[model samples]
Target: MRLIKVDHIINFKLLGHGDDPLDTKKCHIDLNALRAREDAAIRRAEIEAERIGAGVTTEAQSIFDALSKTLPVRWESTVIVVLNEVRVSSPYKPENVVGGAGAANERVKKVLELERKRMQHGRQ
Candidate 1:
């Protein structure tokens, strides 16, 4: 079995490298999207910090290797690194709401209509 080094990826999704129809490469590789996924990985690592010490592992990777490793899970809560930044979901009402999802131009609505017709044989 050989592992191919992939570089091209898009939208947090991996596209595959070979002509084979059943390729695991497509589903497994998400290198370009890792930055967006870093927050979740960090949060997961934080939660599992204790496991690093008492974990049962005979063949442990290097310190740097483990540090660079990303968690296979995602985080729900948004973790902000900058100070003086309030959370957007804070319902307590803030002094100012600037440059946020709510403040942005969000006008994406859906149009719905009925496809049914022929009401009682053309309303006879």
Candidate 2:
């Protein structure tokens, strides 16, 4: 991938060796641009890792993933919101789930219990 700086925007182009004879012969590579891109990517990865490590347990994340399959899920600080109505707080137990319509609340509780059992049994 070749990164081109055009004004303030960065553009990427995929070039194959020997595809463009003239361009290949010229062989004008931007080492600075490549280095900048690499540095930016590394910084982004570090930031993402830090965000994921911020008190979100694997159990809580797994529960959120499962619930998101059939419902709208979002994070409210350390809490997981389901269907925009139900809130599942940390320690993510059935009892920790609160505030939702009747059916949605029941579904969230069932998911929490099922996830808990799955984790306890070490099942994927």
Candidate 3:
């Protein structure tokens, strides 16, 4: 008995003894095309992931906007920055507020807490 091993499965008729020779060209798999398709799919997935990661959530954006009204605020990735000193990470809880010291940081933390609660209540 003859045996053949293949990494990829392709549908083709097996040639029995005394049968006409099989066409090698028709049975070949285009590795380059397969690789290109795989690469394209990976690239598309990466692009989508990057797009999603680049934007902050509506809640985070609203908080940022509110803070911007009375304080120096900017976004560092998904984290919110205030006065270039304090960093508020996602979930935007008061405990997540960090960095800096003094009255200004405390004020920022208070504002964040209030905004977070207000937004939370507004949602319900």
Candidate 4:
């Protein structure tokens, strides 16, 4: 929860709210309310933080240690996954020099693998 500050003022008929006039004692009351409100707000935020810290991370997959849980069992298997392979040939290769296109393919393969991992993590 977020707290927002609000400014309040009294409207005197003679002043007509055009020329500003404020009472300090009235402000003191508002300030006291604001202080106690702030203290209560802080306590609420700390409680929320404690709740978050207490939340259990149940069986999370490390980016390294395989997010693929649930037993990759037999042919029947415990988990199901679909892998994809795509091949695209760009007509324009940069510089068009020797081995440039082959180098590009190697780069594309790495990018594709990275994209796959990213998509999987996003699902998680």
TM-score: which candidate is best? 2
Tens-digit lDDT track of model 1 for 4-80: 55664333656876688667875676776887699889989887663342332222222212222421211114211
> Could you tell me which 10 consecutive residues in candidate 1 have the lowest summed lDDT?
107-116
Give one digit per residue, the lDDT tens place, for model 4 in 6-115.
Answer: 45444424645553448665454568888999999999998555323122222111211131232121111211111212232221122211232555445544543554
Query: Regarding lDDT, does 3 or 4 come out ahead?
Result: 3
Evaluate candidate 3 by giving its C-alpha RMSD to the native, one decimal.
13.0
Q: Please, what are the lDDT tens digits per residue for candidate 2 over residues 16-114?
A: 556666677778889999999999999999855533424788877788777777787877788888888899988889999899999999999998888
Question: What is the Cα-based lDDT of residue 103 in candidate 1?
Answer: 26
After the best TM-score superposition of candidate 1, give how far the Cα of residue 35 lies from its true spot, in angstroms: 1.2
Q: Supply the global lDDT for candidate 2.
A: 0.81
Candidate 2 vs candidate 3: the TM-score winner is: 2
Q: What's the ranking of the predictions by TM-score, best on top?
A: 2, 3, 4, 1
Which ranges in model 4 have alpha carbons more than 4 Å from their true place?
A: 1-17, 21-29, 54-124
Please count the clashing residue pairs in each candidate, in the order shown. 0, 0, 0, 0
- The lDDT of each candidate is 0.31, 0.81, 0.79, 0.36
**Where is model 2 poorest over a 10-residue stretch in terms of lDDT?**
46-55
Best by lDDT: 2
**For candidate 3, lDDT tens digit of each residue in 6-119?**
855577796876734586755878899999999999999985554332477887777887888899776778888888899889888778888987787788889988997888
Candidate 4: residue 30 lDDT (0-100)? 68
**Root mean square deviation (Cα) for candidate 4:** 19.2
TM-score of each: 0.16, 0.57, 0.53, 0.26
For every candidate in turn, the CA RMSD to the true structure comes to 23.2, 13.7, 13.0, 19.2
